[model samples]
Target: MAVPALDTARAAPHTRPAPAPRPARRPGRAAVALAPAGLALALGLWGIRRENSMWRDESTTYQVAHRGVADIFHLLGEADVAHGLYYLLMHGVFALWDGGLLALRLPSVLAMAAAAAGVALLGHRLAGPRTGLAAGAVFALAPAVQRYAQEGRSYALVCAAVVWSTHLLLSAVANPRGRAWAGYAAVASVTCLLHEFAVLAVLAHGVTLLLARVPAPIRWAWARAASAVALVLAPLVIVSQQQAALVGWIGRPGQTELLGFLALTAVGLGCAVLPLRTSAAISLRTLALPLLILPAATLLAVSFIHPIYVDRYVLYSYAGFALLTGAGLEAALRAAPHPRAGAAALAAVAVAALLPYSIELRTPQSRLDDPMAAARAVRELTRPGDGVLFMPARRREPIMSSPGEFRGLKELALAQHAVPSGTLHGIELSAPRIRARMMTAERIAVVTDPPGRRPDDTPQERTKREVLAQHFRRCAEREVQGMVVLLYARPGAC
Candidate 1:
């Protein structure tokens, strides 16, 4: 006799239940995502100009972006190939508005907003809407995120690409189809092209696939997509290597960086071990833990042999941090006897804690040096026909950024203009030529790094110092936030 049908509907004790269906995209989804994007935009725009200040790096962006497209392409071949795309994008931005610092920085604000939205939607897909909103909010409020959101750099755009690509990766993992994987690969490749360090993020994505415990076929699909991204990035990697000296300044992680990483890792680990289930198919811990840790940890590890660890390089990891933090907050809310009150209290505490940092990030003092402030000082210290020199040629950035401030001051050691030469700073005259140029000036303005910086020992820099010391007397000096402006006159003229 046929055995009575085993209880068809009943679950086996050992086997997992079929995963709950993936949440269908709802009409409210856009609204949910938009909330965080709006918040990030508002925060980014709050002090976008930073008291009419721009720093050395931002000045670089301004000068480069204002160049002709052909010139930008020419410059990319020599240096900063990594930021080629961003420079091109900013070219378009300035072409349209040319609103000075506001135009220079608005793209970053918009890109960061997009990134925040991506984080929210990713969290919603993995956990729930509440978690998504909380995660996005956390990311927006993160001091680092706030800092970079207003920067005129590629980091924010790279962050947007990474986050959205990860969102697509989630979709591909859920569906495991060719089109889905292709979509993921396309965006992932762009992310890498934006900045090759984003390849670290792709590696983090691989760990995420493994943590997801997806089927063999899905694993292969992910691998194929990731490999394709790498293949597309190969040329950039090669070119950037030739320009490695650009980042040669990075050093092994310092104590403060190490401590911060460890503390954040501890918090992430705690969130990962929370007794909460994200979904039947994948856990929030699996999705976010690797995203949060792998990119940073790998960079930190590699820095021992070759120090390339900069916190901004892995800023996308903040999305992961926000994701896990959101879950932890949600878990706390669920476990509390009064969820609404608990959320209110949590919100109040988070705002209070982050408010000071938020305000600090918008000030001119937030950056290493204010180029505008230095330029202003140069303008005030010297008259028309006076010679202006940068102690290290690189310090010319402030003058380059605000050339109007030093309108009639001669750049005594000049050769070619920066844009014409396709270099960050123009090629300086030889040491002998610079010294001879210095000898003729009646009064000179010199911009130096803040006191105690290791003095540039290059021959040209040495010549500048020697000429100034031997021939000129200090007439006046002013120390700005991160720069020193000094006026020198012929010994008798002083």
Candidate 2:
């Protein structure tokens, strides 16, 4: 049996029935599909209004965008992000729109919502319409996706491109045609522009198509897609120094924490597929594996050598995995002899699974994400020569480091608002140095979260507040609603 030629397959008769462009479902069917999508998106948008409290990353984003394109290129020419693509795009965004938190972040929110739609379409194409609807609905509700979507970052956009590219990957496998490969190219190109890690996604697709074990042309199509990505990434490779430095901090994500992040990735994926189960079957197997086992295994496996333990690092895997899981569950439901039972099981799993995620949604952690607020509030509070010292300055470093919308301090610096005359730097410093730095300053503030610093940070760093308090006379502490906006003066800075 000679392998079927691409041309012959192209000429082959359409055997799979064309989907009837069915006259619309009853009035609410469309509404129901979109209901969760809308709610998720709306809430996400609302969430970001407060998301920008001048955190280190957000500040950097704002600052980088504030630079001239030439300067940005020069910086990228120096040290860059997951390939300088997001920063380069952000450069244009800051120029056109207000770099305010909400303004800076809208693009990601829209992109995330668009991704939700893609998840639905991908699910629909792989499983069926119901699966598509369920996938879209679940994508909309996802806590992590929503959290990232509302912020000004590369993750949400990457998620959208991943969905689009995954759909094309699916299409190419199902129908190995030139046009399908062409679609793959189109989507893969966007993924390249959005993130370099998306390269992993392209690789995954190659493995998928290879497994489909299609004819030469189909394999060639994947080859073409891979080749395009390589060609596109060639220019970016010039910035390897920048890329390595950014990722240099790959501390071993302890086995438990590493596994936890992987689990979180799964929960997001599983939720996207749960509702699309067949009407008669029952079981959470679909939601259990990719959203659960596979990611856990992937992380555990990856964490050994130098720890590939970052959650956002594997964002591409999370989306595609979820779609496949959704597709599988849908197939199981449709194939189940007891469709009603299958449906009931899926619903039960959804309730049980989501109840925890939902609880997480309602918690304080969800709302405390205001990194850019510090700089914004600082801008409003300061007078000329109002000396600003970020005592236990290490906590403030991430914010000050980037100095932009990523941090909210970029524009402030551009406007020449605060001078970095003195800073405590770290908690390890003797109380005298800390006191000396604090006492000399007219207006001193320490940037710390009351509960604690970032969980991933060192234990020594967590003592920032306690150590600083011993030396500096706590003049006036300002709790800016959610963040620890502590205000201290030198023992006496009149």
* Cα RMSD to the true fold for all candidates: 8.2, 12.0
Q: What TM value does model 1 have?
A: 0.93
- Stretches > 4 Å off in candidate 1: 1-27
TM-score of each: 0.93, 0.67
**For this target, which candidate reaches the highest TM-score against the unseen true structure?**
1
Which residue ranges in model 2 land beyond 4 Å of their true spot?
Answer: 1-40, 51-54, 173-183, 235-238, 241-243, 261-300, 324-364, 367-369, 376-384, 391-443, 446-474, 478-494
- Candidate 1: pairs in clash: none
For every model shown, the clashing-pair count is 0, 38
TM-score of 2: 0.67
Model 2, span 1-494: residue lDDT tens:
34567756876676556878986453234543465457557757664655334344555566666666666665665455453678777777767876577667788878877777776665555445666665566566656775677666788888778777766766676677788878788778777767665676676666555544557677787898789778877676656644565566677777667566656655555554545443211122332233333443555566677455566655545455545555555566768999669878887887698667655553335554444555555555544544444433434543453344132222111112212221112124444444444444455445555555454343333343444465455655555534565555445752
What is the Å distance of residue 287 in model 1 from its true position? 1.3
| Tens-digit lDDT string for candidate 1 (386-417) | 99999888888887899899999989888888
Model 1 / residue 36 / CA error / Å = 1.7
